[model samples]
Target chain A: MYRQPVSRLWWLKKRTYFVFVMRELSCIFVAWFAVFLMVMVFAIGRGEASYQRFMDWAASPVVVAINIVALAFLVLHTMTWFVLTAHATPIRVGGRRVLAMREARVAGRIVPAATAVRVGGRQVPAAMVIASQYAGLVVVSAFIAWLVLR
Target chain B: MTKRHIEPIVWLLFSAGGVAAAVFLPILILLFGLAIPLGWVRPDYNYLDAVVSHWLTRLVLLGLLVVMLFHSAHRFRYTLHDGLQLRWEVPIAVLSYGGALLGSAAALLIVLTI
Candidate 1:
Protein backbone atom coordinates (compact mmCIF):
# COMPACT_ATOMS: atom_id res chain seq x y z
CA MET A 1 0.00 0.00 0.00
CA TYR A 2 1.06 3.58 -0.69
CA ARG A 3 1.94 5.66 2.33
CA GLN A 4 0.77 9.21 2.93
CA PRO A 5 3.14 11.90 1.75
CA VAL A 6 5.46 13.84 4.02
CA SER A 7 5.07 17.60 4.40
CA ARG A 8 7.02 19.79 1.98
CA LEU A 9 8.11 21.76 5.02
CA TRP A 10 9.73 18.72 6.62
CA TRP A 11 13.19 20.25 6.25
CA LEU A 12 12.17 23.26 8.29
CA LYS A 13 11.70 21.29 11.48
CA LYS A 14 15.40 21.47 12.37
CA ARG A 15 18.23 23.93 11.81
CA THR A 16 20.43 21.20 10.36
CA TYR A 17 17.66 20.27 7.95
CA PHE A 18 17.49 23.87 6.75
CA VAL A 19 21.25 23.96 6.33
CA PHE A 20 21.09 20.77 4.31
CA VAL A 21 18.51 22.35 2.00
CA MET A 22 20.66 25.44 1.58
CA ARG A 23 23.68 23.26 0.88
CA GLU A 24 21.74 21.42 -1.79
CA LEU A 25 20.52 24.73 -3.25
CA SER A 26 24.14 25.81 -3.52
CA CYS A 27 24.45 23.36 -6.43
CA ILE A 28 22.52 25.89 -8.53
CA PHE A 29 25.26 28.44 -8.03
CA VAL A 30 27.92 25.79 -8.62
CA ALA A 31 26.21 25.03 -11.93
CA TRP A 32 26.12 28.74 -12.65
CA PHE A 33 29.82 28.98 -11.96
CA ALA A 34 30.40 26.15 -14.41
CA VAL A 35 28.36 28.03 -17.03
CA PHE A 36 30.31 31.17 -16.27
CA LEU A 37 33.57 29.32 -16.82
CA MET A 38 32.27 27.93 -20.12
CA VAL A 39 31.36 31.44 -21.24
CA MET A 40 34.80 32.68 -20.36
CA VAL A 41 36.33 29.80 -22.25
CA PHE A 42 34.12 30.54 -25.23
CA ALA A 43 35.07 34.19 -25.15
CA ILE A 44 38.72 33.29 -24.94
CA GLY A 45 38.34 31.05 -27.96
CA ARG A 46 36.74 33.90 -29.91
CA GLY A 47 39.85 35.99 -29.37
CA GLU A 48 40.86 39.20 -27.55
CA ALA A 49 38.04 41.58 -28.37
CA SER A 50 35.31 39.16 -27.38
CA TYR A 51 37.07 38.40 -24.13
CA GLN A 52 37.27 42.12 -23.41
CA ARG A 53 33.56 42.48 -24.00
CA PHE A 54 32.90 39.51 -21.77
CA MET A 55 34.93 41.11 -19.01
CA ASP A 56 33.02 44.34 -19.49
CA TRP A 57 29.72 42.55 -19.17
CA ALA A 58 30.98 40.78 -16.07
CA ALA A 59 31.82 44.16 -14.53
CA SER A 60 28.33 45.49 -14.98
CA PRO A 61 26.30 46.26 -11.84
CA VAL A 62 23.83 43.45 -12.39
CA VAL A 63 26.58 40.87 -12.70
CA VAL A 64 28.26 42.30 -9.64
CA ALA A 65 25.09 41.87 -7.59
CA ILE A 66 24.59 38.34 -8.80
CA ASN A 67 28.17 37.46 -7.95
CA ILE A 68 27.85 38.91 -4.46
CA VAL A 69 24.75 36.85 -3.74
CA ALA A 70 26.35 33.79 -5.26
CA LEU A 71 29.41 34.26 -3.08
CA ALA A 72 27.24 34.35 0.03
CA PHE A 73 25.50 31.14 -0.94
CA LEU A 74 28.80 29.51 -1.87
CA VAL A 75 30.28 30.35 1.51
CA LEU A 76 27.27 28.90 3.25
CA HIS A 77 27.62 25.77 1.16
CA THR A 78 31.33 25.42 1.83
CA MET A 79 31.03 25.82 5.57
CA THR A 80 28.18 23.37 5.89
CA TRP A 81 29.99 20.95 3.62
CA PHE A 82 33.00 20.98 5.89
CA VAL A 83 30.90 20.36 8.96
CA LEU A 84 29.06 17.53 7.28
CA THR A 85 32.25 15.90 6.02
CA ALA A 86 33.83 15.98 9.41
CA HIS A 87 31.09 13.78 10.82
CA ALA A 88 30.41 11.63 7.77
CA THR A 89 33.98 10.44 7.21
CA PRO A 90 36.28 9.55 10.07
CA ILE A 91 39.89 8.48 9.87
CA ARG A 92 41.58 6.04 12.18
CA VAL A 93 45.28 5.87 13.01
CA GLY A 94 46.77 3.07 15.09
CA GLY A 95 43.41 2.11 16.56
CA ARG A 96 42.70 5.71 17.52
CA ARG A 97 40.26 7.99 15.81
CA VAL A 98 41.81 11.06 14.27
CA LEU A 99 40.22 14.44 14.79
CA ALA A 100 37.68 15.46 12.16
CA MET A 101 38.09 19.08 13.23
CA ARG A 102 41.61 18.85 11.87
CA GLU A 103 40.16 17.95 8.50
CA ALA A 104 37.68 20.79 8.79
CA ARG A 105 40.39 23.28 9.65
CA VAL A 106 42.60 22.24 6.76
CA ALA A 107 39.74 22.28 4.30
CA GLY A 108 38.35 25.59 5.50
CA ARG A 109 41.65 27.36 5.59
CA ILE A 110 44.23 25.71 3.36
CA VAL A 111 42.18 24.87 0.28
CA PRO A 112 40.80 28.37 -0.19
CA ALA A 113 44.20 29.85 0.46
CA ALA A 114 45.69 27.65 -2.27
CA THR A 115 43.73 29.68 -4.83
CA ALA A 116 45.53 32.78 -3.68
CA VAL A 117 48.80 30.90 -3.90
CA ARG A 118 48.06 30.00 -7.48
CA VAL A 119 47.05 33.52 -8.40
CA GLY A 120 50.05 35.09 -6.66
CA GLY A 121 52.45 32.48 -8.01
CA ARG A 122 56.02 32.69 -6.73
CA GLN A 123 56.05 36.44 -6.22
CA VAL A 124 53.56 36.63 -3.36
CA PRO A 125 53.79 35.42 0.23
CA ALA A 126 51.33 32.80 1.42
CA ALA A 127 50.06 35.12 4.16
CA MET A 128 49.62 37.90 1.62
CA VAL A 129 47.69 35.62 -0.66
CA ILE A 130 45.38 34.52 2.14
CA ALA A 131 44.99 38.11 3.33
CA SER A 132 44.09 39.28 -0.16
CA GLN A 133 41.25 36.77 -0.37
CA TYR A 134 39.81 38.08 2.89
CA ALA A 135 40.38 41.65 1.74
CA GLY A 136 38.63 41.01 -1.53
CA LEU A 137 35.71 39.47 0.30
CA VAL A 138 35.43 42.53 2.54
CA VAL A 139 35.67 44.92 -0.39
CA VAL A 140 32.97 43.15 -2.32
CA SER A 141 30.72 43.06 0.71
CA ALA A 142 31.26 46.75 1.28
CA PHE A 143 30.44 47.55 -2.31
CA ILE A 144 27.26 45.52 -2.13
CA ALA A 145 26.26 47.23 1.11
CA TRP A 146 26.89 50.61 -0.45
CA LEU A 147 24.84 49.71 -3.47
CA VAL A 148 22.00 48.63 -1.20
CA LEU A 149 22.21 51.77 0.97
CA ARG A 150 22.52 54.24 -1.88
CA MET B 1 21.06 -3.57 -12.43
CA THR B 2 18.62 -2.20 -10.28
CA LYS B 3 18.01 1.37 -9.13
CA ARG B 4 19.66 0.41 -5.85
CA HIS B 5 22.94 -0.33 -7.57
CA ILE B 6 23.12 3.05 -9.31
CA GLU B 7 22.82 4.94 -6.02
CA PRO B 8 26.40 4.45 -4.83
CA ILE B 9 27.94 5.24 -8.20
CA VAL B 10 25.91 8.41 -8.56
CA TRP B 11 26.86 9.30 -5.01
CA LEU B 12 30.54 8.79 -5.74
CA LEU B 13 30.32 11.25 -8.63
CA PHE B 14 28.33 13.63 -6.51
CA SER B 15 30.92 13.48 -3.73
CA ALA B 16 33.79 14.04 -6.14
CA GLY B 17 31.99 17.02 -7.60
CA GLY B 18 31.26 18.39 -4.15
CA VAL B 19 34.94 18.31 -3.23
CA ALA B 20 35.92 19.99 -6.49
CA ALA B 21 33.29 22.67 -6.21
CA ALA B 22 34.12 23.39 -2.60
CA VAL B 23 37.78 23.84 -3.49
CA PHE B 24 37.51 25.75 -6.75
CA LEU B 25 34.30 27.76 -6.84
CA PRO B 26 35.16 30.26 -4.11
CA ILE B 27 38.52 31.07 -5.63
CA LEU B 28 37.24 31.32 -9.16
CA ILE B 29 34.51 33.74 -8.12
CA LEU B 30 36.94 35.87 -6.15
CA LEU B 31 39.46 36.05 -8.94
CA PHE B 32 37.15 36.56 -11.91
CA GLY B 33 34.14 38.30 -10.44
CA LEU B 34 35.49 40.54 -7.69
CA ALA B 35 39.27 40.80 -7.79
CA ILE B 36 39.97 41.27 -11.46
CA PRO B 37 37.02 43.53 -12.14
CA LEU B 38 37.59 45.61 -9.03
CA GLY B 39 41.25 46.00 -10.00
CA TRP B 40 42.59 43.97 -7.11
CA VAL B 41 44.26 41.63 -9.57
CA ARG B 42 44.91 42.82 -13.07
CA PRO B 43 43.77 40.26 -15.62
CA ASP B 44 46.28 39.55 -18.36
CA TYR B 45 43.99 38.69 -21.23
CA ASN B 46 46.62 37.09 -23.42
CA TYR B 47 48.04 35.06 -20.58
CA LEU B 48 44.58 34.02 -19.36
CA ASP B 49 43.59 33.02 -22.87
CA ALA B 50 46.75 31.02 -23.30
CA VAL B 51 46.13 29.20 -20.05
CA VAL B 52 42.59 28.30 -21.02
CA SER B 53 43.66 26.97 -24.39
CA HIS B 54 46.26 24.64 -22.95
CA TRP B 55 45.53 20.92 -23.38
CA LEU B 56 45.90 20.02 -19.72
CA THR B 57 43.61 22.82 -18.59
CA ARG B 58 40.98 21.68 -21.05
CA LEU B 59 41.15 18.15 -19.67
CA VAL B 60 40.79 19.36 -16.09
CA LEU B 61 37.87 21.52 -17.08
CA LEU B 62 36.20 18.57 -18.77
CA GLY B 63 36.54 16.60 -15.57
CA LEU B 64 35.18 19.53 -13.61
CA LEU B 65 32.19 19.77 -15.91
CA VAL B 66 31.32 16.09 -15.69
CA VAL B 67 31.70 15.70 -11.94
CA MET B 68 29.97 19.01 -11.20
CA LEU B 69 27.00 18.15 -13.37
CA PHE B 70 26.61 14.74 -11.77
CA HIS B 71 26.85 16.34 -8.34
CA SER B 72 24.15 18.78 -9.25
CA ALA B 73 22.01 16.03 -10.73
CA HIS B 74 22.14 13.89 -7.62
CA ARG B 75 21.51 16.79 -5.28
CA PHE B 76 18.69 18.18 -7.36
CA ARG B 77 17.20 14.74 -7.74
CA TYR B 78 17.00 14.33 -3.98
CA THR B 79 15.77 17.88 -3.62
CA LEU B 80 12.86 17.14 -5.91
CA HIS B 81 12.08 13.78 -4.37
CA ASP B 82 12.40 14.72 -0.71
CA GLY B 83 11.98 18.48 -0.53
CA LEU B 84 9.05 18.62 -2.90
CA GLN B 85 7.70 15.29 -1.66
CA LEU B 86 7.54 13.95 -5.18
CA ARG B 87 6.87 10.20 -5.09
CA TRP B 88 7.76 9.46 -8.67
CA GLU B 89 11.36 8.46 -7.97
CA VAL B 90 12.10 6.62 -11.19
CA PRO B 91 11.23 9.43 -13.60
CA ILE B 92 12.91 12.02 -11.37
CA ALA B 93 16.11 10.00 -11.23
CA VAL B 94 16.11 9.44 -14.98
CA LEU B 95 15.42 13.08 -15.79
CA SER B 96 18.00 14.40 -13.37
CA TYR B 97 20.77 12.00 -14.30
CA GLY B 98 19.83 12.13 -17.97
CA GLY B 99 19.91 15.91 -17.98
CA ALA B 100 23.28 15.86 -16.28
CA LEU B 101 24.65 13.48 -18.89
CA LEU B 102 23.34 15.73 -21.64
CA GLY B 103 24.99 18.70 -19.99
CA SER B 104 28.27 16.81 -19.78
CA ALA B 105 28.06 16.06 -23.49
CA ALA B 106 27.35 19.71 -24.26
CA ALA B 107 30.38 20.73 -22.25
CA LEU B 108 32.55 18.22 -24.04
CA LEU B 109 31.29 19.45 -27.39
CA ILE B 110 32.19 23.02 -26.52
CA VAL B 111 35.59 22.24 -25.03
CA LEU B 112 36.63 19.99 -27.89
CA THR B 113 35.20 21.97 -30.79
CA ILE B 114 36.06 25.43 -29.57
Candidate 2:
Protein backbone atom coordinates (compact mmCIF):
# COMPACT_ATOMS: atom_id res chain seq x y z
CA MET A 1 0.00 0.00 0.00
CA TYR A 2 1.23 3.42 -0.96
CA ARG A 3 0.56 6.49 1.17
CA GLN A 4 0.78 10.02 -0.15
CA PRO A 5 3.31 12.20 1.59
CA VAL A 6 1.75 15.17 3.33
CA SER A 7 3.11 18.49 2.16
CA ARG A 8 5.38 20.30 4.56
CA LEU A 9 3.44 23.48 4.05
CA TRP A 10 0.05 21.89 4.36
CA TRP A 11 -0.88 24.28 7.13
CA LEU A 12 -0.67 27.17 4.69
CA LYS A 13 -3.76 25.87 2.97
CA LYS A 14 -5.98 27.55 5.52
CA ARG A 15 -5.62 30.51 7.90
CA THR A 16 -7.35 28.67 10.70
CA TYR A 17 -5.06 25.69 10.33
CA PHE A 18 -2.05 27.97 10.34
CA VAL A 19 -3.26 29.57 13.52
CA PHE A 20 -3.74 26.16 15.08
CA VAL A 21 -0.25 25.04 14.14
CA MET A 22 1.04 28.27 15.55
CA ARG A 23 -0.88 27.55 18.72
CA GLU A 24 0.86 24.22 19.00
CA LEU A 25 4.16 25.88 18.20
CA SER A 26 3.64 28.35 21.02
CA CYS A 27 4.01 25.53 23.53
CA ILE A 28 7.76 25.85 23.17
CA PHE A 29 7.57 29.36 24.49
CA VAL A 30 5.29 28.11 27.26
CA ALA A 31 7.92 25.56 28.22
CA TRP A 32 10.58 28.23 27.98
CA PHE A 33 8.62 30.34 30.46
CA ALA A 34 8.40 27.34 32.77
CA VAL A 35 12.15 26.89 32.57
CA PHE A 36 12.61 30.59 33.23
CA LEU A 37 10.40 30.28 36.31
CA MET A 38 12.45 27.35 37.50
CA VAL A 39 15.59 29.39 37.14
CA MET A 40 14.02 32.28 39.04
CA VAL A 41 12.99 29.96 41.86
CA PHE A 42 16.45 28.43 42.05
CA ALA A 43 18.09 31.83 42.08
CA ILE A 44 15.74 33.14 44.77
CA GLY A 45 16.40 30.04 46.85
CA ARG A 46 20.13 30.66 46.67
CA GLY A 47 19.62 34.07 48.34
CA GLU A 48 19.63 37.75 47.38
CA ALA A 49 22.98 37.79 45.58
CA SER A 50 22.04 34.99 43.20
CA TYR A 51 18.64 36.53 42.68
CA GLN A 52 20.25 39.83 41.77
CA ARG A 53 22.52 38.05 39.32
CA PHE A 54 19.53 36.33 37.81
CA MET A 55 17.84 39.69 37.45
CA ASP A 56 20.91 41.06 35.78
CA TRP A 57 20.94 38.21 33.31
CA ALA A 58 17.27 38.68 32.66
CA ALA A 59 17.90 42.37 32.00
CA SER A 60 20.37 41.70 29.24
CA PRO A 61 19.22 42.89 25.81
CA VAL A 62 19.08 39.41 24.31
CA VAL A 63 16.92 38.18 27.14
CA VAL A 64 14.64 41.19 26.80
CA ALA A 65 14.21 40.50 23.10
CA ILE A 66 13.41 36.89 23.90
CA ASN A 67 10.88 37.93 26.52
CA ILE A 68 9.20 40.35 24.14
CA VAL A 69 8.93 37.70 21.47
CA ALA A 70 7.73 35.19 24.02
CA LEU A 71 5.14 37.69 25.17
CA ALA A 72 3.66 37.94 21.68
CA PHE A 73 3.46 34.19 21.26
CA LEU A 74 2.02 33.77 24.73
CA VAL A 75 -0.70 36.24 23.87
CA LEU A 76 -1.50 34.36 20.68
CA HIS A 77 -1.54 31.06 22.57
CA THR A 78 -3.80 32.46 25.26
CA MET A 79 -6.21 34.10 22.84
CA THR A 80 -6.58 31.06 20.61
CA TRP A 81 -6.99 28.70 23.53
CA PHE A 82 -9.66 30.90 25.08
CA VAL A 83 -11.56 30.97 21.79
CA LEU A 84 -11.41 27.20 21.65
CA THR A 85 -12.39 26.98 25.28
CA ALA A 86 -15.27 29.38 24.70
CA HIS A 87 -16.76 26.90 22.28
CA ALA A 88 -16.81 24.24 24.95
CA THR A 89 -17.66 26.59 27.82
CA PRO A 90 -20.96 28.21 27.02
CA ILE A 91 -21.80 31.42 28.81
CA ARG A 92 -25.26 32.91 28.72
CA VAL A 93 -25.95 36.51 29.57
CA GLY A 94 -29.39 38.01 29.10
CA GLY A 95 -30.38 34.95 27.10
CA ARG A 96 -27.62 35.59 24.57
CA ARG A 97 -24.76 33.19 23.90
CA VAL A 98 -21.31 33.98 22.53
CA LEU A 99 -20.56 30.80 20.70
CA ALA A 100 -17.31 30.30 18.75
CA MET A 101 -18.52 28.53 15.65
CA ARG A 102 -15.00 28.68 14.25
CA GLU A 103 -14.02 26.10 16.84
CA ALA A 104 -16.72 23.71 15.66
CA ARG A 105 -15.52 24.19 12.14
CA VAL A 106 -11.95 23.71 13.26
CA ALA A 107 -12.88 20.43 14.92
CA GLY A 108 -13.91 19.19 11.46
CA ARG A 109 -17.20 17.90 12.76
CA ILE A 110 -19.60 17.84 9.83
CA VAL A 111 -22.37 19.46 11.75
CA PRO A 112 -25.27 21.03 9.90
CA ALA A 113 -25.43 24.84 10.10
CA ALA A 114 -28.74 24.47 11.90
CA THR A 115 -27.21 22.11 14.41
CA ALA A 116 -24.43 24.56 15.03
CA VAL A 117 -26.93 27.34 15.56
CA ARG A 118 -28.93 25.16 17.93
CA VAL A 119 -25.78 24.20 19.85
CA GLY A 120 -24.79 27.81 20.28
CA GLY A 121 -28.37 29.06 20.80
CA ARG A 122 -29.39 31.64 18.19
CA GLN A 123 -26.20 31.73 16.12
CA VAL A 124 -23.80 34.12 17.73
CA PRO A 125 -21.99 36.04 15.01
CA ALA A 126 -18.33 35.25 14.29
CA ALA A 127 -17.46 38.92 14.60
CA MET A 128 -18.96 38.99 18.06
CA VAL A 129 -16.92 36.02 19.16
CA ILE A 130 -13.70 37.51 17.77
CA ALA A 131 -14.50 40.87 19.29
CA SER A 132 -15.08 39.34 22.69
CA GLN A 133 -11.91 37.31 22.40
CA TYR A 134 -9.83 40.37 21.55
CA ALA A 135 -11.56 42.37 24.24
CA GLY A 136 -10.57 39.77 26.82
CA LEU A 137 -7.04 39.66 25.48
CA VAL A 138 -6.72 43.41 25.63
CA VAL A 139 -7.87 43.53 29.22
CA VAL A 140 -5.46 40.80 30.27
CA SER A 141 -2.52 42.19 28.30
CA ALA A 142 -3.19 45.64 29.68
CA PHE A 143 -3.13 44.40 33.26
CA ILE A 144 0.15 42.63 32.69
CA ALA A 145 1.57 45.59 30.85
CA TRP A 146 0.61 47.85 33.70
CA LEU A 147 2.32 45.56 36.13
CA VAL A 148 5.47 45.68 34.02
CA LEU A 149 5.55 49.30 32.93
CA ARG A 150 3.98 51.08 35.88
CA MET B 1 -5.76 0.95 34.47
CA THR B 2 -5.20 1.10 30.74
CA LYS B 3 -3.73 4.03 28.81
CA ARG B 4 -7.20 5.27 27.93
CA HIS B 5 -8.17 5.27 31.60
CA ILE B 6 -5.28 7.53 32.59
CA GLU B 7 -5.36 9.74 29.51
CA PRO B 8 -8.42 11.72 30.50
CA ILE B 9 -7.05 12.49 33.96
CA VAL B 10 -3.76 13.63 32.50
CA TRP B 11 -5.57 15.75 29.92
CA LEU B 12 -7.62 17.37 32.67
CA LEU B 13 -4.43 18.30 34.48
CA PHE B 14 -2.95 19.63 31.28
CA SER B 15 -6.01 21.77 30.59
CA ALA B 16 -6.07 23.15 34.13
CA GLY B 17 -2.38 23.88 33.94
CA GLY B 18 -2.78 25.64 30.63
CA VAL B 19 -5.48 27.86 32.07
CA ALA B 20 -3.42 28.63 35.14
CA ALA B 21 -0.33 29.40 33.12
CA ALA B 22 -2.31 31.59 30.77
CA VAL B 23 -3.84 33.56 33.63
CA PHE B 24 -0.86 33.79 35.97
CA LEU B 25 2.39 33.36 34.09
CA PRO B 26 2.25 36.50 31.93
CA ILE B 27 2.12 38.74 34.97
CA LEU B 28 4.94 36.92 36.70
CA ILE B 29 7.11 37.08 33.63
CA LEU B 30 6.40 40.75 33.07
CA LEU B 31 7.19 41.65 36.67
CA PHE B 32 10.41 39.68 36.93
CA GLY B 33 11.67 39.84 33.39
CA LEU B 34 10.76 43.42 32.57
CA ALA B 35 9.55 45.54 35.48
CA ILE B 36 12.19 44.66 38.01
CA PRO B 37 14.97 44.67 35.47
CA LEU B 38 13.87 47.93 33.92
CA GLY B 39 13.39 49.54 37.33
CA TRP B 40 9.75 50.24 36.63
CA VAL B 41 8.78 48.79 40.02
CA ARG B 42 11.46 48.07 42.50
CA PRO B 43 10.38 45.41 44.97
CA ASP B 44 12.94 44.89 47.69
CA TYR B 45 14.75 41.58 48.07
CA ASN B 46 13.61 41.17 51.67
CA TYR B 47 10.00 41.52 50.59
CA LEU B 48 10.39 39.02 47.78
CA ASP B 49 12.29 36.58 49.99
CA ALA B 50 9.64 36.81 52.66
CA VAL B 51 6.93 36.23 50.10
CA VAL B 52 8.67 33.24 48.53
CA SER B 53 9.51 31.74 51.90
CA HIS B 54 6.00 31.99 53.23
CA TRP B 55 4.49 28.51 53.60
CA LEU B 56 1.30 29.30 51.75
CA THR B 57 3.14 31.06 48.98
CA ARG B 58 5.56 28.14 48.60
CA LEU B 59 2.65 25.68 48.41
CA VAL B 60 0.97 27.74 45.72
CA LEU B 61 4.24 28.06 43.87
CA LEU B 62 4.75 24.30 44.07
CA GLY B 63 1.28 23.68 42.69
CA LEU B 64 1.88 25.99 39.76
CA LEU B 65 5.25 24.43 38.97
CA VAL B 66 3.89 20.88 39.05
CA VAL B 67 0.90 21.51 36.86
CA MET B 68 2.80 23.76 34.48
CA LEU B 69 5.42 21.08 34.01
CA PHE B 70 2.70 18.53 33.34
CA HIS B 71 1.23 20.87 30.79
CA SER B 72 4.63 21.20 29.18
CA ALA B 73 5.01 17.45 29.12
CA HIS B 74 1.71 16.84 27.38
CA ARG B 75 2.27 19.65 24.90
CA PHE B 76 5.85 18.65 24.14
CA ARG B 77 4.82 15.05 23.67
CA TYR B 78 2.20 16.01 21.11
CA THR B 79 4.56 18.47 19.48
CA LEU B 80 7.03 15.74 18.86
CA HIS B 81 4.38 13.45 17.49
CA ASP B 82 2.40 15.94 15.47
CA GLY B 83 4.83 18.70 14.65
CA LEU B 84 8.08 16.90 14.11
CA GLN B 85 6.43 13.70 12.95
CA LEU B 86 8.39 11.60 15.38
CA ARG B 87 7.03 8.09 15.37
CA TRP B 88 8.67 7.00 18.62
CA GLU B 89 5.64 7.44 20.81
CA VAL B 90 6.42 5.41 23.92
CA PRO B 91 9.89 6.78 24.59
CA ILE B 92 8.76 10.33 23.93
CA ALA B 93 5.76 10.03 26.20
CA VAL B 94 7.77 8.44 28.98
CA LEU B 95 10.55 10.96 28.72
CA SER B 96 8.23 13.92 28.58
CA TYR B 97 6.01 12.84 31.47
CA GLY B 98 8.91 11.43 33.45
CA GLY B 99 10.90 14.60 33.02
CA ALA B 100 7.92 16.60 34.17
CA LEU B 101 7.55 14.40 37.27
CA LEU B 102 11.22 14.77 38.10
CA GLY B 103 11.11 18.48 37.50
CA SER B 104 8.11 18.77 39.81
CA ALA B 105 9.88 16.80 42.52
CA ALA B 106 12.96 18.98 42.25
CA ALA B 107 10.83 22.11 42.39
CA LEU B 108 9.02 20.75 45.45
CA LEU B 109 12.29 20.07 47.22
CA ILE B 110 13.63 23.51 46.36
CA VAL B 111 10.47 25.21 47.59
CA LEU B 112 10.46 23.16 50.81
CA THR B 113 14.11 23.88 51.57
CA ILE B 114 13.70 27.55 50.75
Error of 1 at A18 (Å): 1.8
**With candidate 1 superimposed using the best TM-score fit, by how many Å does residue B38's alpha carbon deviate from the native?**
4.4
* RMSD to truth, every model: 10.5, 5.5
Candidate 1 residue lDDT tens string, A1-150 = 996666889888998778778878887888777778788788888988998888888899988888887788888876666545444443222333322212123211221111111222123333453454456546655653342223
TM-score of 1: 0.73
lDDT of 2 by residue, A5-84 (tens): 55557678898778877887776777677778778878988999999999999999998888888877777777776665
Complex DockQ per candidate: 0.30, 0.36
Candidate 2, which segments miss by more than 4 Å at Cα?
Answer: A1-3, A90-150
Taking chain A of model 2 alone, its TM-score versus the true chain A equals 0.61
Write the residue-wise lDDT of candidate 2 on B32-110 in tens digits. Answer: 7677877778877877777778898788778888887888788788766665566688899898889889988888888
What is the DockQ score of candidate 1, to 2 decimals? 0.30
**How large a fraction of the reference contact set does each model reproduce?**
0.48, 0.34
Residue B13's lDDT in candidate 1: 86
Give the Cα error of residue B110 in candidate 2, in Å: 1.5
